[model samples]
Target: MSLRGKIGAGAIALASTPLILFLGTWEGTGQNIVYGDKLARGLPTVCKGLTEHTSPYPLVIGDFWSDARCAEVESLVIRKGQLALADCLTNQQIGQNTFDALSSHAHNVGTSNTCASRAVGLINAGHLAEGCKALAWAPNGTTPVWAYVTDAAGQKHFVPGLHSRRRAEARLCIQ
Candidate 1:
């Protein structure tokens, strides 16, 4: 082609690379955080805090009313689905601790202004399924994720992940 055509192509190619990378990292782009750093920062902090000072739950709910994005995560609890909640958050740390503070905070049943009820409801029931469904259907080129549990009879109940895939088994879990 002409010299101008070659320069234009080169410029387009160079501009696209960083744009792609930035989009990959942004939550507003596709919110690609499946089950690690992203979730940890949001829900884990909420759960841990409410679990600790039960008295502060009302305050928390009122203060952060706009952050419903984490309501599903707050629902991870002991009474509803303790084993799986623990399993999902196992070995997660918040500084020098292995998130025991968060775990301890989870056990108190105050029903105050905190997330214990939601967490319990999610764990015991399949409540997170809706959020899971929403996350799974969002189109951002994200891989599907799911959690599963094996029954005594060896049947596997698949937990829905962020993306929707027909037959991918990488999301198998034993919880």
Candidate 2:
């Protein structure tokens, strides 16, 4: 093969490596984790963070079920045969706006920078891996903040099982 062709092939291989590895090992589907960072966590907003939107949403990024729904149902859990109860929200604001936010994400799972897009964005940016590696406090709470990530398909995902961010960095280098 020509030298140019070889270089191009090599570049392609390198680019695909992470993606191949990621898709094969991505943990942000179905099973989700929660972190301690509050701000970084899922906030009630338009579908996946859209600037212009309509409708209501439910389910925060981290499985924050709505309080009222929880009360009406007399339980924090909600399941509808095939669909597991996924809307668990804290903070009245998050709870109140969840219906809209989740609906919005449910609205666009494959287009734009909606929730799914944010999930992809975070992963591509290495935030998911980085946060997972930086898990602080074992996700048992007490940590300053916690984080959770919903995948491109709106599956619940998290960066839970945290320790100190510094300690996590040390593990990376030592290993």
Scored by lDDT, the top model is 1
lDDT per residue for candidate 2 within 1-175, as digits (tens), equals 4222333454212112332222223212222222222322333332112111321234344454343433232111111100110212111221212222222222222123323333223323545433333222233334433234455566655554322322332233123
Query: For residues 1-175, could you state the per-residue lDDT of candidate 1 as single tens digits?
Result: 3222332454212112332232123223323122222222333223222332322333332243233433333333322322222334312111111112122222322223113333323323443333223222223325432334345567766544312221211111100
Candidate 1 residue spans exceeding 4 A from truth: 1-49, 53-62, 78-81, 84-175
Give me candidate 2's TM-score against the actual structure. Answer: 0.18
Q: What's the CA RMSD for each of the models? A: 19.6, 17.9
TM-score of each: 0.15, 0.18
lDDT of each: 0.28, 0.27
Q: Once model 2 is optimally superposed onto the true structure by TM-score, how far is the C-alpha of residue 120 displaced, in angstroms?
A: 22
Residue 16 of model 2: what lDDT?
Answer: 26
Please count the clashing residue pairs in each candidate, in the order shown.
Answer: 12, 31
